[model samples]
Target: MREHNRTIAHPGTREEQMANQQGNQAQGATKKRRTFLGYLALMGPAFVVGAWQFGPGNLTTAVQAGSRFDYTLVWVIAVSTILMIFFTDMSVRLGISTPTSLITSIKGHLGKWIGVLAGFGVFGITLMFSVGNAVGSGLGLSLIFGGSPVLWTVVCTAAVGFVLAFRNVYGIVEKALLVIVVLMGLAFIASTVVAQPDWYRAMSGMVPSLPPGSEILIVALVGTNFSINAAFYTSYGVKEHRRTRSDYRDITLVDTIPGIVAPGIMTVLVIMVAAAVLGKTGAEAGTIGALASVFTPLAGPTGAMVFALGLSGAAFSSMIANATAGGTMISDALGRGAKAGSPTARIFTGVILAFGLAVTLTFQASPVGLIVIAQSLTVLIAPLLGVLIVIMANKTSLMGDLRNKWWQNLFGAIGLIAIIASSIRLITTLLG
Candidate 1:
């Protein structure tokens, strides 16, 4: 007997070749199983993006929303998270089918100049936050150890950058950062529980509306915090998770749920913690690192350290994630993958350096200021990215059956409007 050679065949066309129909089906089933699990595993990194959203920025935004708006704006996070799921699934769908980052897709659909400008602008926004991350970490060090914040900040920048610089060998970095995010969650959860917040008021706030003379500044702060690059993380989560548009719809839904929920829950935690204590104490002022001024009465310096440590980890993970996302965008946008040093690796190196620049210079302990700059950039870009995606996803010639669904478009429109209003307000507040 002679051994058989197989020929690849197109579906439903016998003349195409002698490919095994049953075998292909089995392989696909197995692959789908793996992909579902992989998406779950990939989520740890993806959620890092959301974890960043909860950082020191939340210290003011969530608390302010709770205290001033009385949870009136609390629903915004839930709304935004849902919109993000819709928008990001579309992003991943476009990415896998088109095999491009959201940035590259925008460039391809629009023009190369837009792509170039977007690349530079996003990195610029991320750079500002990265600086905030580094500065925040330094504040953590200064508070914990009673040392020079600047010197500790430089050490942190050098350490995180040196680690990120490796790019490929970063499981240690990932695991360590994850631990920090978890610790951060535990500290906050414990504080909120101990403080015993008015869950009733918190729940009521979720009805979603603006209250008159309700510390509009704080409402703006919530908008600013949640508005900016809030979706940027969703894009990064999709890419790093490797969920090209090819995921089983069921799996995509599962993944999107966590990606959105984690941040939403984080939003609730801060509001609870802030209202439980800060509301009781009256108006308060302190840098994010110094949350002890408020929380210490509830948990003591030990508790404060735990809270700061958790927030710091959340912030650090976010910085690493954005850095990774920016690196990914650069590689994908310019068709610049690792030919020699590898695009991911090269970009990671740049990200580490950018961290130093953002923190050592522009960023500080003021979570509000850090979030403001980030939101401002987002307002400018969100609409463009939204329109670009809607156009790209709808082109039957480009995406065929993979175009975004009607609901996806509707949610995306909502996100766009929210960001637009947030942006206009940002400009008004900045100018004023």
Candidate 2:
């Protein structure tokens, strides 16, 4: 009886220990998952900013660069993406440090006129890029299903308008952009794998070299990837998410990593696929359709389908975000709320989309020409915006302990230099 009682007691003890151990492990896993999800939540705004910047213009530029110069221009994409990280980080910091939107901060620091002018500049830039978004969305639809670009353009414009018309625009926009970003990531990864690019050449391409007549393509790449509007829009996004300076600034900065890296990876993959499939064959991607066709020969029907899907996702995602940026900035500039769901904001967004659709449909402008013009405009505007952000960020009164660090200022200066150089080159190209 004694032995039986001892055996039972010992077994119960071991069972309780096992159960406790299992409970601890489970708790740890749950905690980890929660932490991961928290980080992902923080990533929402950065992802949208990235998606907005990566749009159809970026796709066209990458395709052209790869098809034209093989992997030789990959270094430009790399450098530009790195610069974006710095700019975006500064924007994020600025957003968190202040209680209001970026335009609002500019208004307080400068004057109402400067703020209004900045708003108009951003609005114009967004409108210019919206043309590409319209073209891209239309092209994507046309590629997938037989239809007129005009019909699809109108349809896409209406669809974006419908989405923006909603009262809870920010939430819907963020979630939609996240979905599109995921789709883009998967489609591009699949396409890149199928292309089987020359690894040796691709690696070497990371070394910077300006092949003759590559200046325009280089500037286009930088302009699209390192978008000034994206940096400006970051503050609104952070505001929409309600992140404040009291939060973990370091973690907030880290959350932008996926957003920044995803676009760069997508660009690189597009370049590689183009280099592998079109570069050798000497194919020209003067239009989005031409770019899509390159995937067919390399990866067959399925690859082409995937590329079209990714392009559409990118185009549509960017269209929504670009319009939102335009509306949000203008509305904020006018002292209407910056929240995307506000009626004033939606109206402005509609106006920008309407203008873009009208221009795209009426003029039937060359998509490539539109992209170049938009990029040049961005080059002209980015320096002023960059200077504004740097100055605002360095203000001790505004940023307090969270002001720009030595390293942040250093990178910001470098980015400014790069932007100025690109602007000069673009101006020279247009003039001469």
lDDT, candidate 2, equals 0.81
Candidate 1 lDDT over residue span 339-396, tens digit each? 1135554565476456555546653444456556766776577566666666766765
TM-score of 1: 0.80
Error of 1 at 44 (Å): 4.1
Task: For each candidate in the order shown, give its overall lDDT on alpha carbons.
Answer: 0.58, 0.81
Q: After superposing candidate 1, which stretches have Cα over 4 Å from the reference?
A: 1-31, 34-39, 67-70, 169-177, 213-246, 250-254, 282-290, 338-375
lDDT score, residue 193, model 2? 86
Question: Candidate 2: misplaced stretches above 4 Å?
Answer: 1-34, 249-254, 279-282, 365-373
The positional error of residue 188 in candidate 1, measured at the CA in angstroms, is 1.5
C-alpha RMSD (angstroms) for model 1:
6.9
Could you tell me how far off, in angstroms, the CA of residue 125 lies in candidate 1 after the best superposition? 0.8
Residue-level lDDT of model 2, residues 1-432, one tens digit each, is 998887585545334434533443344343233366676677677788889988988998898888888899999989888889888877887776665678877876677788888888888899888898998899898888868987998999999998887778998998899888999999988888887889899999999999998988888888889887787788888778766544435345556777888988899989988888765556766556786787777768787888888898999999999999899988888899888878888889999899889888777856557666776778778888888888888876566566789998998899889888889988998889
